[model samples]
Target chain A: MTYPKSINNLISNLKNLPGVGEKTAERMALAMIDFDKEKLGSFSDSITDVKDKIRHCLICNNLSEEDECIICKDKTRDSGILCIVDDVRSLMLFEKNNLFNGKYHILKGLISPSNGIDPEDIDIEALINRVEKEKIKELIIAVKPSLEGEATALYIAKRLEPKNITVSKIAHGVPMGADMEYLDAITLRTALFERKKIS
Target chain B: MTYPKSINNLISNLKNLPGVGEKTAERMALAMIDFDKEKLGSFSDSITDVKDKIRHCLICNNLSEEDECIICKDKTRDSGILCIVDDVRSLMLFEKNNLFNGKYHILKGLISPSNGIDPEDIDIEALINRVEKEKIKELIIAVKPSLEGEATALYIAKRLEPKNITVSKIAHGVPMGADMEYLDAITLRTALFERKKIS
Candidate 1:
């Protein structure tokens, strides 16, 4: 027999999330059916609250409740340095690790011509504007090293060249704890090209 | 920087679901933030509706929106035969494959002395009551082959012995498309013991 209408609707909605398949969504829906009314209500409220309150930071385009995100408003962070990431998720990864104390600019997406994503489609103009207005000494291109990511980084670097900002891409290499024998050729080549000297 | 309070709360709530970790919940939360208000509202409504409307079927203890589940209400299905499953998820799996045409009984959970789950913890009493009231000729115990499942099935079998109902456990053997070379000793032993003669 088919699931009830409400359960079916919830499963369909859950399938919209990344990596959630039909089986996963169905499992989630069935699990939710066991929740008490109060737990379910609070869960529903959280979903609605996120949609209603969360918005992109006006300055850096990262997720925020107000016009300015927490990173953009923090005075202690190095405002002179800005780390540009592909999206808020990537920005969060850096934040979770406490790896970067600088400000951030979320491009929201990359420049993928095949997927109809161009520079104009993302928040490139805002990155340029932020550099021009702020006293930024360095711009770290923390975008992934894919074709689209490289293209977006190059485009941004060229635009910010006239502004005299030190635009640099994050270093690429074999990840720590990775076996050398299992390393892909492309990664090995990139690692060789970007080799650093040891004392 | 940390996520805003609303976003953080949503991520934590999402993490409470089975199999969803911190990273997956964060991804889900971020993805939901991109959903339109109308979509988010409908999604939230679906979550609350499932909790409000869905209830265990009175007859079989399966998830349902009414007093009885769809299978229980369907007169075309064989009422004289009942296929008992461990939970609603297992019932759905059998239904999805169209493998069973009989009525069903959802045990909700298996008996596990170690986990403090006894026969009283699930719907065993309801099953006995239904068997006594209904014209059930064959009772198929389709629970898993784990220790708790076996004990629960054996207990059910013993309970129904005096009631003159034919209680049978689903066969335990090597699954279809499985290579016998990789089969474990216990599975291979069971497969050999339960061998059937070719017609």
Candidate 2:
């Protein structure tokens, strides 16, 4: 009840984040208190910098330092193939594993109608526009295989079919409701290679 | 492998802490990346602030902004009854429950000979001097019941016995080798209240 006001404020702010409880916040606070001043300052600065400098790529909606992310900027990658993902984190995972040599289109979220997030609310239109403009040869639907994921994939596939692009979803070997990052590199590569087109 | 230098540095630093492994570090790193810029800045600032501004209280070895901690500065607290702890984190647990009304003496570390941490390496001399100079009536050992903890308690007990002040160890109702933070509040309180004198 009588904690230092600044410390209490710090703890309160920390509590707002997911998975961080009071004890965890306190432990983090104590760790912060123990960190060197310059490192702590940089740590604080990094938080704001990521928010201010990082944004959805104008071209693909993936996290980007400029109008487009590094993958979009890299000339070596296949500009004709676009991997559509549910979030920037997936894009990062792909980039980390070097599994995808193509460009990415981050949806930023899924089409969860139950959560009031419809297809129109996400970056589906931008993705469609990108496919049309770029004359993309392949559109890989890397979205999760939940009910919403399936619905979104089908919706995107329907929209892209007329455009003559070869649309496919990653294989179902990844267990349902599992995170893509948890899949080992070999498994992920296999999933990507064994992808099937929607009839 | 090709993460932004700053992001990589942060992940590396986070991974260096105890209990945080590769997956946890990745999760923490992603959380930092996703955190609101302003809040992350504050969290970073607090880390440095804690490292730069916080130091061991001169009287009791507890961390404080000044030479003495709030507990040590309070005229109402029973400084004459020093509560000896192995680390500042343990002292905070007592403070969180408002269990102890006395001032604390943090050893800053435990006595682990294999780890090269001995009684002399900590503030044991300062504690002995405080007992000798002050009208200290009781010295409560709140260290764990591990082999190291028992050794530290016995070592400190021998040192203080000549001064005639009572030396007591927290009760063993707490199962052996249990961390103070994990103990339930009532059990911890009971342990404190039912402490037995060592000398």
Candidate 3:
């Protein structure tokens, strides 16, 4: 009886979002109330709308409100140059840099054997079909540098090799401006071994 | 063309939530891809559902899915005792403690002239009406001891002084089990000021 039922309900609903624990949700609910009744109502509506209306594009499995996302439908994108990533977030990070004109294929997940996530469970089959049908000239693997990411990249690389398509990986090395002395032995070795000749 | 349109839209929607900034929203969007797609969809839906289904209770401006929230509808709560809180989050915190058995009235905000918030902006009138109609015996102010909170409490006390209602503020002093040596000057002063005679 102390809390109006709606306030409690809103707080509980907020818990559904990532990083919103109970205490944080409560704080958020209070903040919403402070914004005025109308805004509080909007906050509630927005939460539900995002959940209901937003979905992954069926083709690329990227967040979308339609069947094919904007990137997939855009004519300006070079469909032949595909960048494969472990999640939709990585694609966004790349887009923020505005350096790539290629299309993206979200893997949805990596081959995490410890967690029982296998490559077969993700959209690998769709990726293969996309490569074949879309006449993709290059498949650039840009997954994280974790063990699972490396394994997934390798799996995808092997799959694409049979079609005679160019399979490349974004190089993993010390970040820009990082000192060479601080670099780990394995990374330093990889960077040295894969060094490209500067023309 | 850079970020899939759907992903961008979804991230933008996420940014509207309480405590969600651009960076946090981006991280959450990416994390969503790692979770079950269906669950992510449902999480978004829940937000909209809560917004549409819930509203403020007419009597107390507390959150409610119905015209009157669960607390307002309940027959068991002591209507005579009303606990006044500056924000709805305080109500949630008290609910976690499970100590109070009375009803609650959320002010929605505290009186803060600096931030352009005053008593008129909140549900102060509704609070007075509830007190009058219910013939409440004790009104316990459970707001924080912040400058705004203190100012709000003083304002509410003055307004209710004419009503002959017994108004009391919650205690503010050293937290239980906290060492006195570790306590700052403000807390020490509050502890000394709020000292109760023990038998």
Candidate 4:
């Protein structure tokens, strides 16, 4: 499976990307050869630029070029309500949909005992410190709904208990446009348990 | 859908790669942030290195760091039996599987009239020239089985009609480990058409 040094080098580097496998890396490396010099220069420069420029927001662990993320810097967004999420992607998802108009705290990862990840391994301490210092009125757990999500939300809630802040998690139920029969039992149960009454 | 400048730049650049959509590009860019400085540097340098170092092999249009590709330069391989392929990836596939020990002539693309691609758009001229000058005894058209593949192979064969070369195409049949019932109509028909007699 020997290839030319440069081709091999690029292929190997491409494989380090999250979803790219050996075959995909090889295909991508081959595709790059078709790119003109200008495109290649910018592509290469961006890879370096992304690393050199982007850093975690000082306050919320969100991706930012400056000390604080754009959301954190905005004066109008609610600072009293803090949305705790698993990572920046979750924050991005919320932001993209314009679903939440509040401050966010990125935990970086959730607690998964089976996977050896703990609350301490993530940014739980930072979340607690941020909530305390900022005097946030409400804490919303917006992590994914899974065992880890449940554990993380409960842990954060317990931590904020002494501070006497209102802690709540986003509801887990059947999603919009989901087929009822195809829904999982736990989700169905949650959907029924959290059913809203119409006036 | 506003993101930081560097993150947006990298995401847009990543989307240019074949088979990468916006979502996948975002995921890959986000994953790159977890990379250490050394990893990021090497990844960035290699992107530029692949473009700087690799060039088309002078002899067969294969990717190469030198004048000729490794296969074309090898003195031991059978240059008389040249394998004609659509691109370098196809050449690499054959090489990786140890299926061919002969030199490969990359056409770089297939002839697709509907897509406005013609015989002159590919490396057919170089192929014909190679066959005439090198006196290649046999040409194996190892391109994939499709309308474009058929057109490309036939076009090359027509060009070499005056050269008196024994040109043949690779056999198409049912793939190994494939379920007979799940096979598509064209593949099934191809399998039946190319079926061999029992010895």
Candidate 5:
């Protein structure tokens, strides 16, 4: 049956989200109809608020509400270390694990010639400026192990080579405690090639 | 890292949607931050419009903007045949297939004693009133085959028994073109028990 114009609009808008298809959008629209007016208003307001308030950090280009992101502003985080990631989501992942007590730089995207995205299209220039001006001694590249990710990492490493900065990429291998048999060919090859001399 | 207050709120609200977990919600929130200001505004407006405009049909309890839903308001559909579904999403599924040209009655929910949902909790009374007041000759029970779905269909069938209405439930068996070996035992049993005479 044809839904109301507003309902259809909501469903279409919801379809724009990642992983949401037509059926899932329709289900979400129907579920929203059951929400109370106050809850619906708050939910809608939250969407608008996110768009209005969230902005890129001046230093790292990471998502923030102020001029500088929390990571950049914090005194405890090591200013001598910087982690570069393809997007804010990856930066958040590292933060969630509490594995890196350093500042971050969000590239926003990788260099992909197929998609017409180049080094200039992302925040690469800002990253260079940050590394040149800041007291960062080591730069960690934490991008996905895709072709575009490799290209972006290599480009950044070459650019920072003249500045005498120690640049490194996160290791690629089978995940911790995962079955080696299920690992993909590339991951297995990388794991074997990068095998450490454990004493 | 702790997200901004607004971003965190948006992520929490997104998690309320079906199949969306913490990671999915975070990804959605991050993606939304990349949307242009105009697209973001339109998305937020659509949500508010859906909340303000969508309502239940006064006659069949289906979702609508006006007093009657599209199915109930359509003059070309057969008024004598009515399909009763547990929710609007199920009704939309039938409509999407373009197989049913009859009116629809949305029960909104199924009765589950364990969940403390009773007959009065849904739109059962409205279904009875519609059947009595309208020119309904046949009532198609299209609820799911779960315990709650069966109980709801049976209860509705018994309630309409005294009205001389031809109450029929949708067939329960193996899906079309599914292999017998892959089919579950309950489905195979139901398919065998409900086997039709070829004549």
Candidate 6:
């Protein structure tokens, strides 16, 4: 028998989330019954509040509540060196491990022609303008090592070429602690090609 | 760099969902930025609406919008043949495949002593009472074939023994389309023990 309308509605809406499918959505809907009313209220409020309050950082395209994001507003972080990433998640990843000391520019998307996402569709022009206005010394493209990520990085580098700005993409090779047998040909090839000499 | 307050709140709230960990919650919260205002509003409403509108059916403990669940309200189903299931999920699974034509009684909880749950905590009394009041002739215990499920089924059967009710547990065997190589020893033993001869 079909679930009541309310439950079915929840299942459908839950499917809207990334990586959530029908079975997972059903599980989530069923699990909700165990949650206390107060928790549910806060959870509901949490989802709604983000939409109502959060917006883009006018400067760097990072998600923010105010006009400027936390990073943009912070004077402590060095702003001269800008690290470009695909989205807020990538920006957060770089921040989490204290890997990068420079400020960030979130593209919020990458170039993928198959998905109809063109170079102009993303925030490339805004990035170029940010570089010029802020007098950024270095642009480090730290997007994931995917085809689309490479395309976006290359496109951005070409755009900044005329302005005589230094553009560098993050190194792509075998990851740390990865098993050699499991490494794909492309990664192994790239690792060898970009290998550093210790002599 | 930390996300703004709104994003951080959403991330924590998303973590409240079953199977969603810290990283997944962060991913979900970041993904929410792609959702439009109207979609976000409805998604938020969908979560809250279920809590407001849904309740347990007094008769069978199935989740419902009204006092009685859809299955309990149906007069066409065979009320005499009652099926005892672990929860609404099991009830739905049985109903989905047209596997059972009988009425259902949701236990909602099983006899898991390790989890500090006992027979006294579950709705077994309601189930026993329903069997007598409704004159249920056959009780098909269809709970999952697990330790807690067996204990629960045994407890219910023993309780109803004096009433002369015909209580039967569903068979435990290797499922259809299952590969023999991947089958666990217990399942293989069960399949062999419960095997039916065609000769």
Error of 1 at A9 (Å): 1.2
Per-model lDDT: 0.89, 0.75, 0.76, 0.88, 0.88, 0.89
Model 1 chain B scores worst on lDDT over the 10 consecutive residues at: B26-35
Q: Kindly list the per-residue Cα lDDT of model 5 for residues A45-69, writing each as its tens digit.
A: 9999988888888888888899998
Candidate 1 wrongly placed segments (more than 4 Å): A112-117, A196-199, B113-117
DockQ of predicted candidate 1:
0.72
Q: Higher-DockQ candidate among 2 and 4?
A: 4
With candidate 3 superimposed using the best TM-score fit, by how many Å does residue A171's alpha carbon deviate from the native? 1.4
Candidate 3 lDDT over A25-135, as tens digits, reads: 877665654465455445444434555556777777777767888888889988889998877668878888887888889886888889999878876889999889989
Candidate 4 ranges with C-alpha deviation above 4 Å: A111-119, A162-164, A196-199, B111-118, B162-164, B176-178, B182-199
lDDT of each residue in B21-114, candidate 4, tens digit only: 9999999998998999899999989988887888888898887888877788799999799999887778878988899888888886899999
* TM, every model: 0.90, 0.81, 0.75, 0.89, 0.88, 0.90
Q: What is the per-residue lDDT of model 1 for residues B130-155, given as tens digits with 9 covering 90 to 100?
A: 98889689999999889998999999
Model 1: CAPRI class: medium
* Tens digits of lDDT, candidate 6, A120-169: 89868888889999999899999989889999999999988887778998
lDDT of 1 by residue, A82-118 (tens): 9999888888889999999999988879999999998
Q: What is the TM-score of chain B alone in each candidate?
A: 0.93, 0.78, 0.88, 0.91, 0.92, 0.93
Name every residue pair that clashes in candidate 1: none
Per-candidate DockQ values are 0.72, 0.33, 0.28, 0.67, 0.69, 0.76
Residue B14 in model 5: shift from native, Å? 0.7
The DockQ-based order of candidates, best leading, equals 6, 1, 5, 4, 2, 3
Q: In candidate 5, how many Å is residue B157 off?
A: 3.8
Give the alpha carbon lDDT tens digit for every residue of A94-163 in model 4: 9899999999988879999999998889969988988889899999999989999999999998888888
Please give the lDDT score at residue B179 for candidate 3.
Answer: 83
Which docking category, incorrect, acceptable, medium or high, applies to candidate 6? medium
Error of 5 at A31 (Å): 1.9
